[model samples]
Target: MPNLQDVILYESKHQEKDFVQPHSHQTHQILYVLDGQGRCQLNEHTSPLKPDSMIVIPPHTEHSILAASKMTVLILEFSHLHVDADTREFLIKPVFKETKVWSLNLFVSSEIRQLLRKMLYEQSQESIEYKLGIKLLLSQLLFILMRTNQSMAQLDSNTLRSSWLKEYIDSNFYQITSIEEMAGKMGISSRYMNQMFTEVYDQTPMRYLTEVRLTRVKKMLTETDLDIVTICFEVGFESLSTFYRVFKKQVGVPPNRYRTTYVGMSDE
Candidate 1:
């Protein structure tokens, strides 16, 4: 089930100067280029786009694209669960620089590329539950992109310590992991990790960790009916106090109240 919102997809040739109309969705939208090029003006930046690119736009921020070539694009619109105040803000916070482009790893193993091809081909076929195929394939596409983006970051880094630290976060992020543990595993001090992470990511290690945890927790809260306390523990917050504090500080509400807001939400 889609926790954040419904899913939609389109692959069509768009004309130059054709606009999608300046609009925002109630859920996040991801645009994956299948062919051609374009310019995406999101927030304030305007950058040239290319084929095999991906852009994730969070909810309710004005954005648009200008076709640079006859464009073939695959678009997915989905909602978030557990999108509590904290997660909500993070989602709304820019995931990427506005008006930037990210190149996909075309060198992804042949099997993975074949899978994507199958999805796209199967999608063009008709089925009573065609959406099922769309969802499954899109999920695969996203997982591959997420993993590739992370690996690229690791490779582009110059330090062995940096690579290890990032790998540890990627591996252990699902549970209640901490920067100190990240530092410990990297055989360095948390302070040292923080300095490097800040230089590399513009955010402290702990801050990035909190952002990841909070994003996952929000998904849980919105998607599952797990009790608040249980959800907190599941997402890796040991103390309800810390959860509540972070929730309020970043998300702008307490947990219980945040959950309640979604309970009656029309879309949820």
Candidate 2:
């Protein structure tokens, strides 16, 4: 009964059917895995899912889903309705490393999980207080998600060295590159690499890597039809599980559902 409209929730039991193909949407999507394992094949990237993971799929990215097991996913789709710097950057811009798209962590920590649960519980409430309460809670949760992802890059933050590091990440994230190798290649110590991105992008190179990956994965989600596993390797991710974790952390919605929203929105 849940598609990308209003406050929707997906409670499918063993969704083995192929409900759709790769597509894009008018509304942005958010998905949280309540339970079970799954795979998100976004454009050319495929990510394997785990319980408690969350994903954000930017609007207009074509993608599909191939569930690995039974799953309960909480899905939210909202129009291009909010205005803020965060909302603007989130609209598929180069400020990617500057937005939630650069998420480098996915553990929903107890704090965020609890907040999400509370909002979901209040979704159907019609009272003005309940509606405002949900909005405020959602904003807090978004802030937490973005902030946590930003903190994960504190290993070697450097603002002074951003020009060099940003160039490298923008050009070469598709290969098997490590933070150390990238730092060495940049002619600076790894510590400096971390510092530079924080300085330049307000995020570390490692954090930018996740953003780079998601940005490209988003390309695949919008333009291709590859399966989730194939999409994962194409994006230079070795394991499906790791890709899923990182993808969910950044995009905030399952790839398939995100893509489905695109198709659904276009039809409307």
Candidate 3:
């Protein structure tokens, strides 16, 4: 039950040449660079700041940031979170090790970026039980960062490649035409890429891509007024027959009938 105390989270956008005077906080601070370029000085050492860079500054560590180009940073300040001894020993301690600043690869960075966005949204909405929500989200964020740090050493190059491939298909499945095109973009053979991807994710890239597209199609069918033909093409099916056949096979009902049944249930 790790609980954050006195949390303060905000984003600072700086214009070129802008700088923050040296300052220290009584609470631990996490600085995440979202956009642009800068340099962060912690004590006497400095590190370049670019998109996906992260810094964890312990309380009382004097630090400053200088923007070489326009920059956007998310700053999170909080007191030492009360946590179970086991969590503090393993996951928490390693994250704030001697290395105060580092960069995350694209896949891990994307996950962190999404969590940060959700935290920002929660902070903005301030709905009921928002503090609790933020605390849970913070825990999730820390767990992810810790696991990412651990996995960096254990993951092989092929594993990393597979992770990146999965992330790409997840984000761009609707626009992807073929596995060969994706393999070319990654500069790897389709056969090898497919083998590695399947090894890591337990499915071929095309199967994963279809799963992603159909997931979106289901959401649109139930929540939106878009017709089946439009939904099919919108989700990259290329034609209604193919979309309908796959949708019915996977979902066990035609798209229209599924939507009619589910949406009607929701109204009751």
lDDT of each: 0.67, 0.63, 0.83
Whichever of 1 and 2 has more TM-score, that candidate is 2
Worst 10 residues of 1 by lDDT: 90-99
**Of models 1 and 3, which has the larger TM-score?**
3
lDDT of 2: 0.63
Residues 1-268 of candidate 2 have per-residue lDDT tens digits of 2343344333444565434467777666666777777777676787776776666766767666667777777765554344345644543232223212222344545666687678867775666676566656656766676566555554334433476567767787778458888877768888856755676677777887878888777767666777777878877787889888878777887766656655334335
Q: What is the lDDT of residue 71 in candidate 3?
A: 98
Candidate structures ordered by TM-score, highest first: 3, 2, 1
Best by lDDT: 3
- Compose the digit string of candidate 3's lDDT tens values, residues 32-151: 999999999988899999998999887778999999999999997766564446656775677766546768989888988898888888888878877777777777887987887777
CA lDDT, candidate 3, residue 50 = 91
The lDDT of model 3 is 0.83
